[model samples]
Structures are given as C-alpha cells and as structure tokens.
Target: MGHRSVADLMTPTAITVRRATTFKEVARLLKEFDITAVPVIDEAGHPVGVVSEADLLRPRPTGGAATAEQLMTSPAVTARLEWSVVRAARVMQRHGVKRLPVVDTDGRVAGVLSRSDLIQLFLRPDHAIREEILEDVLTRTLTLAPSAITVDVEDGLVTLSGTVPRPELLPVVKRLCHGVDGVVTVDSRLTCDSADRT
Candidate 1:
C-alpha cells in the first residue's frame, strides 16, 4: 500500500519570516494568511526558528517593537519531505508543536506541515481505502485470493468479511486494513477455514 508522506499534504509554498523581521510584520503575515504560525528563516533559506500566535501574544521584556528572532521558539522543530505522516505527527506531538517547518535533503526550508496537513490523510476517498485493503493487504501481503475476502468501507470505517486460511491471518488483515491512511476503524467478521486454535 502507498501511505501518504508529509510531502503529499504539506503546503508546498510556505510563508516565512526573517530573524530581524518586526513583530508587527510577523503578526500581519499570520493574520493575512489566517495561519497560527510562521517559520523564521535565515539568509540561506534555512529555518532558524518559528514564530507563533502564542509567541506574539506573550508580552516582551522591552515592551517595545521587537523582532522575530526575539519572539520565535529557537532550535526549530522540523520535518522532512520523505517522512511518513504518522512519523511526522509523532514528532509534532513529542515537541508539543502544531506545525513543523519542512526541510529538503540539503536542509533548506521547503514547506510547512501543520496539524491540518496530518488530518488530511484521514480525508482520503473511501474507494482508495478499499482498494488498498483488497489489493495491498489481502491480495498482496497475505497472498489471499481476490474472492477470499470482502472489504466494505463507509466514510473512513472498514468492514472485512469472508474467510481466511488461518485464524491468525484475520487479525493481520484487520491490522493492515486499519493501517491504511484513511481508515478510522476495522470491523472484521472474517472466519478461519484452518482448524487452528484461536
């Protein structure tokens, strides 16, 4: 099965701020784009930090017009283009961040992956999900006949029926089906033809 990578969902063109950019400018960009945060980049287009709405909201010690370098969270949390959506989400959760500045192989700022980007995976079409379950899981992985399993998908939920060669393969079917990008849950009513113990 082809799982979606961060590159598939991230905004290819990201709005960024420079280290010396004024606080007002960062706030304006955020509001103009209707985004909660923007990545701070260097002259080479390498991300140095991220300036967020919360960063802008926090009162500064100078109580004057500050710059993005002063307001941004440093040692920027980032993601790579090839990272799996699941891996990107775990990184974001581990860092307690809503967005990640996406970098290229050479480490230049390419785009930005947000919580919304990750959520889009679950929005894939139901037909695609069904195809993956039937082709990738049952047919390819388990080498089961096309007629051996019946896969039904409604919204993001998957229901697997029919019979498998062994009882163990039933759970494997449910698991691999659930692992598909758009799947929300698995309702397996599969039976086993083999007289194996449960």
Candidate 2:
C-alpha cells in the first residue's frame, strides 16, 4: 500500500495556547482535554512554539510566574499536509518529540499529530485489524525477507499464504503471526522448494 499523508491522519481540531498564557492555564487545558501538548500561537494565529507536559513539569524558580513564552520551545518542528506519515515519524523521533503540528502551505497550523494518534491509527479496532496484524508479522518475524509472504486476517483469525526460499521460515512465520495483537489463530500454508526444505 502507498504511504498515507499526515493530513489524512492528523486531528484538525487542535487546542492552542498563547505565549502569554500562564502555566496554570496551560495545565488546565491539558487536564481538561486530556491532551499531552498544545500549540503556542502568535497574535496572527500562526504557530510560533509548543508546550508539552514535560515542559510544564520542569521546576520553577522561587517567586517566578512562568508564562507560556518562558516555558515554550520555539522554532517548532512542523509537518506539511502533504508529508508522509513515515516522514513525520522520522521528524518526531529525530527531535524526541511526542507530537507535531501540521501546517498549511501558507505556514498556518492546520492540525496536530501525536505519537498516540499514530499508534491509534493502526491499532484502533475500528479499522481493519488485518492490516495491523500483517504489519506486526512483517516487522517482527520476517525482518530480513518480509516481502516474501502475504498475510490475510479476518475477525482475529490470520491466514498466511506465500512462498519463501527457506522451508524453516514456514513455522517461524506461523509463530510470528500468532504473536501479533488481536490474532486469535493462524492458518499458515507457506511453502518452499524441496531443495530449500530442512
């Protein structure tokens, strides 16, 4: 399958905070929305910075009333609507960030993308579970030659059918498929040439 764009997966309705907002207010927003972070927007409604839970947890100096401007991280790492989710994941990992702002062509914030959002995209029960199961199988068991096999999942049951050069791969594939989350049973019919069989 082709890569999905960040905009396709991003939550367009995002909560935002101003630079002058108080830490107390920021904390309230997070708690009220059950969110981990919020975009810091300027007067023009452009994202200029970001504030996360970790930033708010940092100890403050005595008698100091920290503003969002003082606690926010600037020069934000943002994603374009056209960017692939893979690229967004790389950017988040590179910056050690949990979320990224999705920006429009004009550099205005359009949405938010978070680690939890990405995780839920694949793991959500509302989506076809097969895709998630197949992905898990490919990543965990067939790391070296994952493309050699095909996986089909339906209602928690997995049916793996494909050909691998090594006969020993069949049982390994079965074990891997069985190990995936939401996989209840594995029906593996993988085959290998006689010469490759052990």
Candidate 3:
C-alpha cells in the first residue's frame, strides 16, 4: 500500500482566525467548530501561530481585551501535506502538540492534522491489516512470492512464517511490517537457507 500522507488524513477545511481576532471570537470559533485550537493566519494566508483553548485560559493582562496575536503561541509548528503520517506524528510528539497545521507547497495553510487523525489508523479492521500485509507488504514491498511467506493476524498482532530468501532481510521485513498502519506487533518466524548468503 502507498504510504499514508498528512493530506490523506488531515481535515482539509481548517478553520482559522486572523492575528487581530479577539479572544471572545476565538472562543466562539472553538466552540462553534468543536475544535480545541485554530491556526492564526497572516494576511497572506500563512499560519503565523496557533491559539488553543489552553492559551485562552492563560491570565490576561490588566483589563484590555487580548487578540489572538497576543495570546497565540507564535512560529507555529506546521506539517507539509506530502509528509508521511509517521513524520507528522513525530513532529507533533517532538513539539508536544496535539495538532499541526498542514501547509501546501507554497507555504499556505491547507488543513490540520490532529492526534485523533493519526489514531484513526489504529481503528482499521484486523482483516484489512492482514490483507495489506499479504497483498502489499509481502508481495509488493518485499517482492516476495505469495507462497514464500505465510501471514496471520489476530487482534492487530501479526505472525509471519515460511521461507525468506535472505536471513539478513528478516529485520527489514519486520520493519516494513511495522510500517503498515494498524499493525500492533509483528512476530517473524521466517527461516532462510543457511548457504544462501547472497
């Protein structure tokens, strides 16, 4: 199967606010859209920052109303739409963020990819995961014949048994198995001909 990209899972119609948007308006947008955060965009439609519910709750200065610019976390962390889902997830984890604004090639905000979107991969059925392994991973990715490997999946755990061409490639196969979305664990039981070290 093709690697899942940020654009594949992101919500393309991300709601955004201008830097000058008032705190009340931000709150309203959050509530109205049922989202935890929204990107603050510049006049050029690029993400300048992100204003989240937590940011809104931070103590405001004196009595003057604050805008998104004053409350937002600037230099927003963003993801490119073409990035693999794994890369996007890594960015979010590294930044300690729950969501990232996905930008286009031109650096314009296109959408948002949230933790929930990444989690959606784990919800795939066990059969689908199994089919992908047998049809895509083994057959296509590893270029192994259909009978060269036996695949079994139960509760997201995968078991691989049969003969592989090379022993050194066992780890590579395992890593590829892990790359399949919704795969929980992989147990490799493949054996190779001892003298076939090429």
Candidate 4:
C-alpha cells in the first residue's frame, strides 16, 4: 500500500493562538477545543512555537501575568502536509510530543496531527493489503500480469506463490510487500521456469 500522507489524517482548521494570548485564555482554549496544545502564530499566521498543558501548569515567575509568547516552546517542532504518517510518528517520538502543528508550504498552521490520527491509519485491513500487493507490487512494480502471481493476505501476513517470469525479481517483490503498511510478515512461495532457473 502507498504511504498515507499527514494531510489525509490531520485535523484541518485547527484552533490557534497569538503570542500575546494570556495564560488564562490559553488554558480556556485548551479546554474548549479539547486539545492538549495550540500553535502560537505570528501576525502572518506562521507558527513560532506551541504551548502545551505542561508548559502552562509549570510554576512561572510571571504566573498569572504570563503570555503564550513567554511560556511556549519556541521554534516549534512541525510536520509538513506531504510527510508520510510513518515519518510523522518518528518526528513526534523524537520530540516527545503528543501532537504536532501541521504546516503548509508557507510555514503557516494548516492543521493539527495527533498520535491517535497516525495510529488509526497505520493499521490497515488484510484485504486492502492484499489488493495493493497484487495490483501494485505484482502488476505495476514487477510488470507482471495479475494472473502471473497469486497473493493471499491473512492477519496482516502475505503469502506469494506462482511461477515468476524472472526468478531474480522475487526478492524485489518480497521487499515491496513487506514495506506496505499493515503487512506483519511475508511468506515467499515463488518459483521460476525450469529453463530460467540456472
């Protein structure tokens, strides 16, 4: 299966805040929006940082007087719309963040992506995985007829069996199938024509 992009799962029209937004308002927004954090945008609507619940709850010198600009984690860790969900997960893990501000080409806040969103899309059904391997891996990638190979998927595991035109390409097919999302394992049961088996 093709990699799902962040844009496919992100929540567009995310609630955002300005740098001058007060601490109390930030807290209120988090509660009202049911979000853990919000991007602090500049006048041009570009995110400069994010203010999460932890940042707001920690003791501060300014206390009640503090604003989002003073408390936010600066130079925000962001994700692009085109990034694969796998790559986005790595970024979130690297930063130890529960959510990321999705940014457009101009660096403006396009949406918000949460851990749940990635997890929901990561686990695909066995039938969908089978179709991709048969349609993409076999027909398009290997340039073989659909009838040339038989693909079976069960519980995220794929089994491939048939007489391949090029025995040398079996390894390539296995690798591609393994790369597909939700493919837990691959079982190769392929052989080649006797004359080509040298």
Candidate 5:
C-alpha cells in the first residue's frame, strides 16, 4: 500500500485572518467558526503567521486591545503538498503544534493538516485480514515504550492509551500507528508529563 500525502488529508481553504485584524474581531471569528486557530495573511494573500486560541487568552493591556500581528506566531513552519504523512507528523511533533499549514509550490496556502485527519486515515478497515496485516506492519517498525502504553485492536481500529515521557512523543506514537496495516484509526489518550529529570 502506498503512503498518503499531507495534501490528501488536509483541510483545504481553512479560515484565515489578516494581521491588522483586532483581537476582538479575531475572537469573534474563532467563536463564530468554532475553530482554535486561523492563518494570518498579508494583502498579497500570503500566510505570514498564525493566531491560535491560546494566544487570545493572554492578558491584554488595561483598556487596550491587540492586533493579530501582535499575537500571531511568525516564521511559520509548514509542509509541502506532496510530502508524506510521516514527514508531516514529524514536523508537527517537532514544532509542538497540533496543526500545520500545507503550502503549494508557490508558497500559497493550500490547506491545513491536523492530528484529527491523521487519526481518521487509520480508522478505516478496508484491508483484508486486518489483524495479521497490523501485526506484520508493526513488527517491521520501531516503537518507543516504557511498557506503560496500551494498544488495542478492534475491527482494525487501534486505540492507544498511556503516558508518554513528553508531549512531543504523542504525535510520534500516532505516526507509528499510521504505518501499521489494518490500523483504520488510532484513539490516543496519552498524557505528557516529565518522566525524566536530572
């Protein structure tokens, strides 16, 4: 089976906001759309940054509002349309983000890829002899564990539960599950807390 591309699973034409947009307006957009974040774009329609729900929660100056440019995260890390799902997951993990902007060859925003999309890809049971396929796929892959992680396979859906050493490992573990056959979806409820301190 061929691996899926980020573009294949991305949300095309996601909601975006301009840098000059006010905090109040940004909040309204997020509330109206029920979204956590939105891309910040320039007049040229190029993504210059991103504003997230967390950014909005930051305490504003007394009697003063903020602009998207002040709250947006710049130098955005992005993924190419043709990049593999594994690569995209790695980037998301490394950046400690739940989503990534997918860009076209011309650096124009093509879509957005989220963990939810990746999970859905693994949640479909369309392959034959799924259990055997899953075993075959997992055996060839390297998995990280403290033996605290639990894996369950039912009707080709993989459910993972446990605590990882770091939040970053959560996405890595999810990506590993995606490599396994017959894994229609992975439901991960892994918590991240410091496991190593020296």
Candidate 6:
C-alpha cells in the first residue's frame, strides 16, 4: 500500500555513454555530473552495459581501457521506472550494484536509481511510522482499536506491546507492522489468550 516506485525516487535525467566513447570522455562525464556510473547505451538509447568509476580504475594491459565499450561491464543491471522501491533494492542487492539504469517499457534509459535513493525510506520520521501503524495497519486493516496496540517508535524501530483480540491476530499484527514504511525492525510483545477469542 502506497509503496514508492522507482519513478518517484529516481533522478529523471540519466547520464549515458556510448560504446565508442573514449574512456577519458566517460570519466569526464562522471566527474561533471558528480555521479559514480553511467549506462553504456546504443544509438536507440537502450542500455547495453554500465561503466563505473571502479570499472575505469580496473587494471588493463595496454595503457588502460581505450573506450567505454572496452571498459564497460556488459548486461547492465537495470530497474524499470514502475518497479517498487523494495523490488529495486532487492535487485541491486542481488546484483551487487550500487546503482541501476532505470528504463522505460521500450527499454530506453529513462533515469537512474542509486543506493541513496532507497535510503530515503529509512529516513521517515518516527512519528510518521507510528501513525501509519496505528491508522493503516491497526484501525483500517485489522479493524482493531488504536488502543489495542501500544506502538512505540524510535528511529524507525517499532515496538508493539499490548493486547490483541486473539492469539491468531498476534502474528497478523506483527507482520503488518513489519510491512509499515520506515520500520527498521519489529519487537512484538503483544499478549493474547484463548479467553479473548471471539
């Protein structure tokens, strides 16, 4: 619910390099934009690979790599603009990449997503996290009174301690709380008893 998509967080303008672009030019572009990497695109502006500062610094045999094509890591790790931020972060983690070339449906490079973009999710205020849990998770979804759960949030960490309608709803509460935006972790100390069952 209300998950942020890559399009919402990504930098709309992406810097790119052509396959034939000299390595020196690529380096200059990166420096000019103050970015760490760029997509190596085709004439159609579709990404073919990516070249990062690390790629440029790699050891080469003949006086260093000559062009972006030679230095680039092929099969660029990319994210679609519509993908949820959670999905993009998972892909980046799986591929061991710090940035992703954000693309459109036609596979044209549209933007860029960096590790820093995902970090914004964690920067949500503690009060906001608590309110979301109390309103969205408890009141709306679970149909439980706000007072049924004592939600304490500090730096995005959520602590749930109170009473639930039944033992079965205990896990449900914890799960929904974990899914709340900006929740770093959930400490559920909620109590329930069979006598409370409806």
Q: How do the residues 39-100 of candidate 5 rate in per-residue lDDT, one tens digit apiece?
A: 88888767888888888887767313789999888867788999988799889899998888
What lDDT tens digits, residue by residue, belong to model 2 across residues 15-73? 89889899889899999998888999888778888989998988878214788888888
Candidate 1, superposed: residue stretches over 4 Å from native: 125-128, 135-143, 165-179, 185-198
Which segments of candidate 6 are over 4 A away from where they belong?
61-65, 140-143, 166-172, 191-198
Q: Model 3 clash pairs?
A: none
TM-score against truth, every candidate: 0.80, 0.63, 0.86, 0.80, 0.63, 0.83
Candidate 2 residues lying further than 4 Å off, grouped into runs, are 62-64, 124-198
Report backbone clashes per prediction. 0, 0, 0, 0, 5, 0
* Candidate achieving higher lDDT, 4 or 5: 4
**Candidate 6 lDDT by residue in tens digits, 1-198:** 556789988997657889999888988999999999989999999999999999989987643448888998989989998998889999999999999999999999999999998898889999999999999999998898787678999998899988886778988888888777788899999998557445
* Residue range with the least summed lDDT across 10 consecutive positions in model 6: 59-68
Model 3, global lDDT: 0.88
TM-score, predicted candidate 6 vs. hidden true structure: 0.83
Query: In candidate 5, how many Å is residue 20 off?
Result: 0.4
Angstrom error of the Cα, residue 66, model 4: value is 2.0
Candidate 4 lDDT over 29-117, as tens digits, reads 99998888899999999999999999999999999889999989998899999998889999999999888999999989999999998
lDDT of candidate model 1 versus the reference: 0.88
lDDT of each: 0.88, 0.77, 0.88, 0.88, 0.74, 0.88
At residue 66, what lDDT does model 5 achieve? 88
Error of 1 at 6 (Å): 0.5
What RMSD does model 1 have? 3.4
